[model samples]
Target chain A: GESVGLHLPTLSVQEGDNSIINCAYSNSASDYFIWYKQESGKGPQFIIDIRSNMDKRQGQRVTVLLNKTVKHLSLQIAATQPGDSAVYFCAEKTAGGFKTIFGAGTRLFVKA
Target chain B: DVKVTQSSRYLVKRTGEKVFLECVQDMDHENMFWYRQDPGLGLRLIYFSYDVKMKEKGDIPEGYSVSREKKERFSLILESASTNQTSMYLCASSSDRGSGNEKLFFGSGTQLSVL
Candidate 1:
């Protein structure tokens, strides 16, 4: 039973501070990793994704770091704002790439 | 940008009733998936269809069935739904562009309550 899990279930950050959410995956051969942000009453939205070949990839205000050696994935938000408060989860692309297994998720709360 | 749309935002049903959850994607994606989300449980795949009239059972496909009559539409059906089936249903689609890493676009999700 392969699984994806997060180091923390919840995180609180002061507005304007940087935030880091971590995830650990069991599948070593998993090549694709994705981060999703889900807000209240809304579906999960794509934040960023990184392939196994890349150590890090940057988006507008977020960076996805993939440490394939340790089977660890992280999402970092720069200058976190109140709007950044949401449930964030990590997913790994499985065999055939059609199915995805997701982590439990970390609830990010940015306090002003 | 891709758009995935679920038929309903919220639905209420009684025990033993049949349920149908509809999903449509405008991007003409080859892959469509149905997943159920629960608190602390994350997203569990129920079923997925890769092409028209073709389907595959996902991780937790016990009480569910799926239909892909058209390229853009995928449907999830529950026969004699139970109370335990109450959960938020999410529909997603991705391109089968041969890349191992698939970027999925999701619908708003249907919050179904089985009473």
Candidate 2:
């Protein structure tokens, strides 16, 4: 069975601090990984993605790190703001398949 | 801009009633998927279609069925809605990228409550 999960269910951060959300996956053959952000009443939005060939990928104010050896993935947000408060999820895809599995989301609350 | 739209933002249905959830994508994507978002469980794929008249069951597809008669439209059918089926349903589509790693574009989602 394939299981993707997060280390934390909820996290609270100050408005100006950085936030890091972690995920652990059980599928060793997963070749691609992605991070998504979902706001209240909205669907998940793609943040960043990294392939197994790459260890780190960065976007505007966001970074995703993939540790294939440990089967772990992480998303880091720099200078987190109030608007950044949402549930973050990490998804993984095994090669030679069209399916992607999402991890239990980590809810983040930003204090003003 | 890629756009995925679900037919309803909110729906209410009674137990044992048949329900239809519609999704339309304007981007002519080759792949469409239906997923349910629940607290603590994340997004669970219900079904997916790669082309017209084609569908494949996902991990949690036991009580659900799907239809994809047209390239831009995908539908989820619940033969007899149950209270357990109440959750946020999301629609997503992705363009064909021969590389098999294209990103998904998702709809705002439809929250359904079964009483």
TM-scores of all candidate predictions against the true structure: 0.98, 0.97
Report, in order, each candidate's fnat: 0.67, 0.62
**DockQ of predictions, in order shown:** 0.73, 0.69
Docking class of 2: medium
lDDT top scorer: 1
lDDT tens digits by residue: candidate 1, A1-49: 8789999999999999999999999998788899999999989999999
**Model 2: residues with Cα > 4 Å off, grouped in runs:** B96-98
TM-score for candidate 2 (chain B): 0.97
Worst 10 residues of 1 chain A by lDDT: A92-101
Tens digits of per-residue lDDT, candidate 2, B1-115, equal 8899999999999999999999999988999999999889999999999899999999899789999999999999999999999999999998746555677889999999999
iRMS, candidate 2, in Å: value is 1.4
TM-score of chain B of each: 0.97, 0.97
Q: Distance (Å) between predicted and true CA of A15, model 2?
A: 1.1
- B12 in model 2: Cα distance from truth in Å? 0.6
Worst 10 residues of 2 chain B by lDDT: B95-104
How good is the docking of model 1, as DockQ? 0.73
